[model samples]
Target: MQKVVIVEDFCIACYNCEVACVATHSRSEEPIKAYKRENLRGRSNALVEVNGPIAFSAMCRHCKHPWCLDTCISGAIQRLDNGIVYLDEERCVGCWGCVLGCPYGVAHPNLKGEEKHAFKCDLCIDRLEAGLKPACVEACPNKALIYDETMEETEGAYNR
Candidate 1:
């Protein structure tokens, strides 16, 4: 299944996407409180930036040849048939290969900022299972991010 990709060309680099992401994933469903919680408790699911007008919005690629899976000597990362990659936290040795191997720089050493195990977007497998869009994509105001299992159009190729 083809997936949502960003069109940075259209991005205004407003922190809207970032803010939206926090709201989407937060326990309180409010942004400011979410920030305080994430910083104070140091729990996080992902990161966002827009200063480059080139903010990176990313998730696991669930690759046909997944570097995270291959690099994990601990055998913690697993690729599922549904095009989602996940981690077995118990088996993770915190070796950080997945972080280093991730071409997008999305995976990181401490997702919760508490545990040392690396983590990245699991594409919100729960949401996908519910037939719901990823929270980040659903919450983005600029419509900068999108989620689609079926890519019906290649319209962007001609736009640039």
Candidate 2:
């Protein structure tokens, strides 16, 4: 399965990945409109962490055994045969079970809408199907985020 691999050393903490993610997932599919008009500043599936001089981008690992899928009370989380973990917002009940169960802490609570729900990186399934790389990976100027297709499934929370 293809996964987004982080190269911490190459990260510049520019937040390009986050902006790209919001734009890609936004209704308008435009960066300026997504942030200014849609007010989707914090809705990016990709997150950037900065500590001192160290920084790196993070998203869902799409684990072989996803805790989010296992703990979803409403059955909103499902793992596809291609290994992509998906969250069906319409079926979500705001239980936050997946949020609590996600070891990577990537699962987020979507409180911006009238009905809240849990969300995380979907690995840009739509973009992937269209033969395009994830927004975050494509937007990284330094190539810190790589679309790695040769990654083998591993055991534990970091599995992909």
Instruction: Please list the Cα RMSD from the true structure of every candidate, rounded to 1 decimal place.
Output: 3.6, 2.7
lDDT tens digits, residues 1-160, model 2? 5678888888899999999999999999999999999888789888899999999897898888899988999888998888889998889999999889999889999888666887799899999999999999999999889886776545433422
The local distance difference test score of each candidate is 0.65, 0.88
Q: After best superposition, candidate 1 residue 149: deviation in angstroms? A: 1.3
TM-score of candidate 1 versus the correct structure, residues matched by position: 0.75
lDDT of 1 at 30: 81
Clashes of 1: 0
Clashing pairs in 1: none
- Cα error, candidate 2, residue 89 (Å): 1.1
Error of 1 at 137 (Å): 0.7
| Alpha-carbon deviation at 98 in model 1, angstroms | 0.7
